[model samples]
Target: MEMLRRWLAAGLWAGTLLVPVHAEEPSVEAGLRVSRIGGCHDCHTQGFAETGGQIDPSMALKGSPVGFMGPWGTTYPTNLLLTVEPMSEDAFLDFAKTLETRPPMPWFNLHYMTEFELRSLFRYIKSLGEPGEPAPEYLAPGETPKTPWIVFAPPQMPE
Candidate 1:
């Protein structure tokens, strides 16, 4: 019986060694990583997409002037810095979990983010300097957008 117990322990130890370990990155660093890979800069930062991501970091997350026009009307990226600037970490987490917004915002993705990831994101955005101007208001369907906008119309099927 003692010999069997020793063998089982050894097997468990060996199994652990075979498993790959991925340590969680620190909150702010993890947030920054998530932001980059999640494509937050692509729409939230002005010139970020057009410049192929060469824009200054200072300009990031301040919101873009461009609008994405679709069937739901025009939606602009919000100023992330300002959005979370006043929220407590816990409040931000709760807000993220329940966030819902217009088209192209990908607000649904926030519901899947872990608490640690959400906290990290809030910390990272807060670290960026003071907030800038807010994006233009949402335009109802058929309303003309004053700023430069991208039309997200459905593609024509090649019959």
Candidate 2:
């Protein structure tokens, strides 16, 4: 009994010595939920809104050809996969906090998300595999876009 106890103790100690400590793996499922409810798919995924939110998982976050035009100019939904491809989790969190985009993008929302949520989101985007093609370049104010775009003029107020 004594010999067995000693052997077990040594084995446990050896196991602990070999185990590497790392941060918990970010939850991809949580990230997916965030993507859906956060309106990411509505813009970033081509045809997502038009198709009534039934986009294939394979084509998600690849960006859209459609642009949102306003007084600030025209902007396209960026390929989120490519946007974060080069960023580490920390960098992504920092970028999210400071993001400021034109017109339609809800950039302010990122600033309010917790670090865990952001990390999970980053992991989820990265897990989608290879990045998709880049979106069209930004068109300055008054410049017409070659692709289809939605105009964002203010609604006429009733006098």
Candidate 3:
């Protein structure tokens, strides 16, 4: 009986070792689809010109306009390419985890993604890493350099 037990344990160990150890990388198209569904490019990339929509493929996910304004005041999205540097499967996992802490970043709600789905998104973002021109500096509200929408108040009548 002891001999049978030993044989069983050995077989189990061998079987475990025989299984493939490497994880498969996702296809670029699959990754893009995930990003699209997650709305990653909406805040990360510059807004579209036509319908003011979010599908600007030419500047897709390249980070927000440098001087762009948002509800949080003047700020730009981080260049995801720089954030995903030294790309590796593990690095991708780390990046996905960061989504939890991101603010005004709606896609971070995807904390429930399976490891495979996260990997797909990471791969797609990494594939778009060509350096782009720097965006212009943004002036804060009430600052000297005014935005196009600034309006001056009229003089008040005597009370």
Candidate 4:
């Protein structure tokens, strides 16, 4: 009986020692949920030609076209998937800090997220593996020149 007890104690101690010491891997789905709510995919993901105007699930959060336009300039959004490369924890923290001072990114508002949430988001992005093909190119300058001087009024107004 004593020998059995000793064996059990040693087994328990060994089991404890073999247990992982680091925190568990962040939940990718949970982080994705938060990102969806946070609108990360809206700006980051490219849309597909589905009947219902669905997002391309294959390209979610993969970043914007380099020259895509909106209210922002000709810059595309960054890929959240960290697939471009593995970002160190410090790099992610620095990126989060940029939200405080950058425009067009709306990072300032996202600054309100807790550090844990931010880390989870980061992990989720990082877990996306690698980036795919580059986004489409922007139109060249003057390729579709604006001829403001030759502007015409509506048909009725012109008449």
How big is the positional error of residue 75 in model 3, measured in Å on the Cα after superposition? 3.0
The C-alpha local distance difference test score for the whole of candidate 2 amounts to 0.88
TM-score, per-candidate, Cα-based: 0.81, 0.81, 0.57, 0.55
Tens-digit per-residue lDDT, 64-130, candidate 1: 8788999999989998988987899899999999999988889998899887788888888988888
Given candidate 1, what's the lDDT at residue 153? 98
Error of model 2, residue 122, in angstroms: 0.3
Position 69, candidate 4: lDDT: 35
* Poorest lDDT segment (10 consecutive residues) of candidate 4: 145-154
Q: Over all chains combined, what TM-score does candidate 1 have?
A: 0.81
Question: Cα lDDT of model 1 overall?
Answer: 0.85
Cα deviation at 21, candidate 2, in Å, is 20
What's model 1's lDDT at 140?
A: 95
lDDT of 4 by residue, 1-159 (tens): 999999999999998887764444556776777787787776677663232345566777887663433322234456666433656866776667665422356777567876666777777777676676654433342343221112122355555
How well does candidate 3 match the true structure in TM-score terms? 0.57
Model 2, 45-109: lDDT tens per residue? 98788788886777899888899998889999999999998999999999999999886999999
The C-alpha lDDT values of all candidates are 0.85, 0.88, 0.63, 0.60
The candidate with the higher lDDT, 2 or 3, is: 2
